[model samples]
Target chain A: MTKYLAVVSSKAEITALEEFAEQKLAKDDAIVLLSHPYAYGEQARLPGSVLKTSFDYLNREELVEIEGERFRLVPNWYKFDKEFEKSILYKGIQLGELPFGEVDVFFRENLRFLRGLSNAIRKENPDVVLTGKNSVAGSSVRAVAEKQQVKIIRYFELGKQRTFPLFPNLTTRKVSESKKKLSRILSELGRAKRGSKKTVFIASRGYLGNLEQELREKTGFNVFPLELFLLRQSINPLVAVKPFLNKKKLQGLFADAFNKYKQSTGFRENMVFDGVFIGDLFEFKLQQFALLNFPEFVSLVDRIDALFQKKKPCLLVVWSDFVPFEKICVLTAKKYRVPSIAIQHGIFPAPIYKKAGFIRAFAPLTADKTAVWGRAFKKILVDNGVEPGRIVVTGSPKLDSIYNRHFEPEKFKQQLGIGNKKLVVCATQPASSTNNPYQMVEQVLNVVERFPECFLVVKPHPVERTEKYEQLVQRANCNALVLQKTDLHALLNAASAVIIHSSTVGFEAILLERPVIILVRNQKRSGHTGKPRLF
Target chain B: MSSCLASVLQGKKLNELKKEMRKFSLERNICGDGKATERVIKFIENTAKKTGKIELKTK
Candidate 1:
């Protein structure tokens, strides 16, 4: 049997990825030696036949005496606050102290831990050691494996291949500008050594809105929304596309697509009502646009020249899925010796079409270090050839609030004003180039209508066309609730079952233990079943 | 100056290098190794004694 060591910093990431990996490894004879930063004395029983190290280490008395086949206690090393402790008590996982200290001290401690783990590996000598890329645990595993000459496999769940390049380039530009600004400021500082003021700027995209204030307080840097850069660049879609495309092909295709799309304004106008149809096309077009607009190439060289004018170094932090930008960032970072960190924006699952020639050929290289939402994404990075040492599985701070959430079905039903009915959450996917979402939704609705005692909660994909769905639901005249701004987790907790067509929310619903039915009709040739379907 | 392991490791020396050539290789961040630390310290002490040097002493 293949023995594997999986380490995750957060419970949620561990929970999601453990289940996913277990399912994949079930067919093969394997035992997973699981380690987490938090104690897993409660909420254990992950998928597949696996041994949890933390669980084994725990004394019998420490195990939560929970009754049920599904319940098991696994040890983890996370220290929780009072409120979190209460929640952990409810869930059954014991909380442990998180090792926190000065960065150098933390790293030395981490290295010491690795030495022991390496010895453990030597004793057990597992065929493979699996971990997230760049995570502390993951890095520790890699370091140990390197010392011991063991095979290490890394995986990343959120494989946004294209976005990796764009960040480096953007950071290079930012660093160049910062260097110029810093030189002038430093020169002024030199002239007036006393009473000179210095300011550091920190900027992030709206995606990192949750961290804006925290980052500001920690670093005493001016925090600005990443949209500021978009606005600064005028959201030049072309600026994003040019790095990947052949110049002539990009220009010709862009002109043709733009003109064709413009002439078909009537069809395009209807897209607001049919988001699926237009969203997929729009995504493809944007990808094309990125290829054509190679302006960043010339600009990057000019920026490199400017960097030579100033002597100070700058740090660039990027988090996004725009691939060309990431490539540029990587190249510039390497060229200028600037430190660059890429934060994983969301759970990035690999494109399902692993066998596709184009996708395989065009896959972009990842960042120096990637911050992942969970172990699921970290695993995805490892699977894609990223070294485990470069991945950080920081639990999605955004979903940290959701980790402790528990909902009562009765109370949820009362709030939604649906009485004594099984709730079905229907999340729609936008139409892709090869799939028609309207037909899929209509088909699923047909199945849903058969169950009169069921209420369907429709959460449309952001880019989905809603008018048709609204009309279809009205025509069926069933107990249907259409929500635009309601929290998905709340709705998911309230649901008895979920129906989706290729949206990622389906997987989230499954993680929440809701039965999900995937509507498969008119899907793209890309081998991805979109989101996993649960029956 | 490269050891056999260094030659096989590619890139730079494992201790000096921060990045990996490939993204999917395994890396770890281990903690809570009092036992292993002691073992390593012992090993170094023995090696230092054998070599007639006091390099293993803690600062």
Candidate 2:
């Protein structure tokens, strides 16, 4: 029986957790941590679990009821020793940790809430800890739990597939009973992509960064793709050997690699313990029975070789060098003597300033030639020991989309029903960076509230739906049109000004000739959070 | 120097800002010629020429 507690995100996850609790948890013997967005938290369906929250033992007056949501917000949530709080916040900053938006708001609630949760976990002293996400706030809680020597079980969902992996470390979490034909996976991606490529195999995780359309304009070749479930960090770890290849022979080849990986003494020597990916080498070593030697990589090599013989692409345009699949893509390309190129997808050349050398040191720069925005990005790659000849400055094609001039600003304004009002576009990125997008809208709403003639257009990041914000808008009683399924550039083109926390839209504003404000509310002093970074 | 100029120009009148922006654009050559993708394609094609065969027609 599992002795530890569980952290849940939503009501839907509550059902899954209840199932998990009933199946594995001891009766009347579990602690719970609910990182619920609303103030109400969960009360109805949770059995044999207790919420390890600030309110669990707090005075009722301390919790402020937030309107329009089932939850309350603690405005003065920094109930801990002030200096200790300061140091924890600074530790987050020193780690180059992204504080979703409003650092003060995030840290305060975390201090009040997670402190209670961590304390409860310490008191319970359970063997296993379960959670939904291992990002940001989850990262903080995991740090607290790691010291207690607790085993972690994470519940992850990829489309219709759900996985429960009791992990020893960050990586090595496998999806059981989920394996698809590599050909079928590739074909599904191609079908979803709908229009393009040169038999060129581009290993990507998310949307192809508009590269496929640009490649179509440049070259007529088909772009067959392979995207490992980068979101889950779980791929088909086993590759099926053909009818003839002796399994023992392949296993023999893998044993040496696995032993070398397992036997590595130093940080740089371990193949699996690379800084970019948090993987467990011990688990990898134990997988010899699953794959006949060389793990699934030998099979990847075989499948890719077959694909090359069939598709015959000129090169590979991989999406990100950060993901593990890029390593496989590069190795396969090297074997076939096919060129591999990685496009810098983000606004900035990665490795947040001080850690420029850290990216060079830790992350695997596997692409033969990195297609970057300009000389600056090319410089970063070359500094990182990538051959200077291999760095090509490919001015971002996504930015090139703005020049297409497809959407009329006036027409877009008319469509938004903001007739003659000066459009103040408030763009919010996905919740990964900012836990609450409502904060971004709140910031814009605050400023737009002052400007009587300004029409606020809340443009949400494509990944998360904005339907949830309708109620928040209704509560705030703000005249805001939360836009969905609209062209961002067209909206940006229409905007008299754009307000953002950290976002790439600032560059779009520059391209579209609009005023942009980067808001980082807290600075290195009195209030805690400082002026924000507008990318 | 560029950021300093932008910071100073932030709250200026629209016409004044536009004039300053026009001047800045003139001095810096910030305008695109719509040939970035073309240049990138050329670079890619040139790079691919080493290992892959391409059929280019005479213009």
i-RMSD per candidate, Å: 21.3, 9.0
Q: What's the TM-score of every candidate structure?
A: 0.40, 0.53
DockQ of each candidate's interface versus the true one?
Answer: 0.01, 0.15
Give the lDDT of residue B59 in candidate 2.
19
Clashes of each: 89, 22
CAPRI classification of candidate 2: incorrect
Q: What tens digits encode model 1's per-residue C-alpha lDDT throughout A1-535?
A: 5666555433444554566565666556565555543222223355564544432333222221111100110111111123333322211112111111111123223322443355556666777666555344554554456557677565435222223234343565555654554454344334432331222122343333245434433332333333333333422446544443444554454445444543454434432210112222223333433343323333433333343224222344455323433344444444454444555443343343222211111122333555555565565566666677776555443343344556677877888899787777878654231234555555556766666777877788754446666766776756886775466777887776677655657655644555555554423323345433211
Residue-level lDDT for A306 in candidate 1:
42
Q: Which stretches of candidate 1 lie over 4 Å from their true place?
A: A1-209, A217-221, A229-318, A323-338, A345-363, A373-376, A405-421, A431-435, A463-468, A520-535, B1-59
lDDT tens readout by residue for model 1, B10-59? 32343322222112112222111212222222322232234321121211
Determine the TM-score of chain B of model 2: 0.44
| Residue A81 in model 2: lDDT | 28
DockQ of 2: 0.15
Chain B alone, model 1: TM-score? 0.32
Error of 1 at A96 (Å): 49
TM-score of chain B of each: 0.32, 0.44
